[model samples]
Target: MIKHHEPLETAGPTVGAGAPAAGTAEAAPQDESEHGTLQKLKVMQFNIWLGGSEVEGGRAGIADTVATVEPDVVMLSESSPERVTNLLADLAERGLTYFDNKNPDDRAVLSRYPIIEHTSFPSWSKAVFSFGGTEIAAYSGHLEYRYYVTYLPRGYGGGTPPPLETSEYGWKKIPTGPITDADLIMRLNEASGRTKVTQTVLADAAEERSAGRLTLLAGDFNEPSHQDWDHRTQDLFDHHGTNVTWSTTKAIEDAGFCDSYREINPDPVLTPGFTWPSDNPGADISKLTWAPDADERDRIDFVFYYPDERLRLHDSLLVGPSGSIVRSKRVQEPGKDRFWCPTWTWPTDHKVVLSTFHIATR
Candidate 1:
């Protein structure tokens, strides 16, 4: 699910490695004492599939989606440096100027506003920028893909190598029934290092919030949320009738971050917000699915924000193909959950999460 690429073309000004981008220093300062200034801010969480190289015209599709949505900030996963370069150029041609720190990691932050400061970690990155006098700190992450224990409950291998019965090299079906032990599932999920990495992000985000910055975190977590897996729908989505309090999302919630998508769309049964195994018209079904015989659809991708008096969640929606790969077939999801389908070609096997907020700035 990870890929490397050679640098393509560069478009707008990009910051050098380990340094802040150039635009923020030039931004005019707005007095913090002013009040009643509210601006609509839209943030998008996207995983450009293998840097948008898995399908033809996929990179262009990424640019098109950003241009169409016009999000103020984009937390990008699987964004190779090459893909980021090419995407900036593509967006520039479309008359939209976006800036990236030229992150060397797979996860990167792209912003329509000036990137005042940034820091990058092993699996994630953060960008601090100002929007109408309200400082915002945004963290984007793409967690480890190995030891995806959710698949174990679906009667499939979870990409962890042997020694364990549920461990297998690739996406292979096991001859056993669903593993319904909640503790075992949590242990395997912990081994993936998602919880550890998320804790690091939360610690840093806490500092930012203490400094009075509105904080937003979004990513392709590669794990289900604790909120989604209660007694309500554990039997559905191949949970095998077991309820799991997935540790990663639980940590974020415990740290006082609101799951933005789930906040607006509360009912998991009606608006599941499944983000993975999206039906890509340009790619084959085999490439899209990990478990061929299971309803592996899950709401793994997410957007979380530390609630503040300055921030109000307006709306959030999944942006991608309406149909998803269910049991290895493209099936249209039926419910109140509707996607903001792209007018251009849809890219990636993960649907993008776009959330709108009204940020009050002085």
Candidate 2:
């Protein structure tokens, strides 16, 4: 989802513990391992809204988010070649250095270490980088946003015109009624080409895994996860009493990748991680809501990693506003999930997903 241009919010200095001071580097942990040593690797999945141009002071906020998180790797969605250059410069000014694949697409992968190799596809980008002596194959994706069938169950059109009639058109509130047919929902959702894109990513990750490298995939899938749409949450979050095994995430799970956020917090009811329609004080409600009369908050962005003997998940947290736009209003999430609220301005329309892992170096 994208937001219209709004008056930019002024970014103030953000000083926090854990973040390294300017012109300095964070000291790496000295924990030793049987093979080599264990190094902390933090991965961040963020969709900087339209290259951080949608919200006021969003550009600075994007830089600040990365600086504050101090992630070892970041999979950025909705980013352009220019945005990558700007972000590299921004981070450098903060006394942090980062590396990118230099992909010319809307998605890019940034790493604290130099990228050893890289490749790009129609919908995603991949980079192979070494961290603490281990090679990591990371993929960043920003899938197609059209045919958003999740809105159909909420009584809004999924952007599929003609033949398919809906109670409401586009993101307007014309409550026709909910479409709870599981079959129809999956059919329309598959037409979005997200699954196809995911398949390509899975294939590439498989090759990387075969080579003994750790694999990670993260981005804005523009789709909900099957794990979150089970019976427990069928009636919550305006799901309209239908459960769907959304294809993209299901495919990833089927390929042996674990959703880091969900793995850390298994109970969907207690920790429903909604990433979209993030409550941005800098933007009007019009830009955040797709179905103004219904709860459209969803966990579309994610951080998934293939489990390996060399990799161990430590923690994962949502990073952004604690509140989200539900029924056209900024409502605080009622779940037990905790958010790492940015001391600086929150940059994007989607909440950032940060996952921490300990990778054994060889």
User: Which stretches of candidate 1 lie above 4 Å from their native place?
Assistant: 1-34, 162-165, 168-170
Per-residue CA lDDT of model 1 for 21-111, tens digit only, reads 1222123332232355666788899999887789887887888777766678899998888888888888788776888866788899998
Most accurate candidate by TM-score: 2
Candidate 2, residues 170-262: lDDT per residue as tens digits?
Answer: 655445577788898898788788999889989989999889899999999999999999899999888989899999999999999999999
Model 2 TM? 0.91
Per-model TM-score, in order, reads 0.89, 0.91
Give the lowest summed-lDDT range of ten residues in model 1: 1-10
Error of 2 at 142 (Å): 0.5
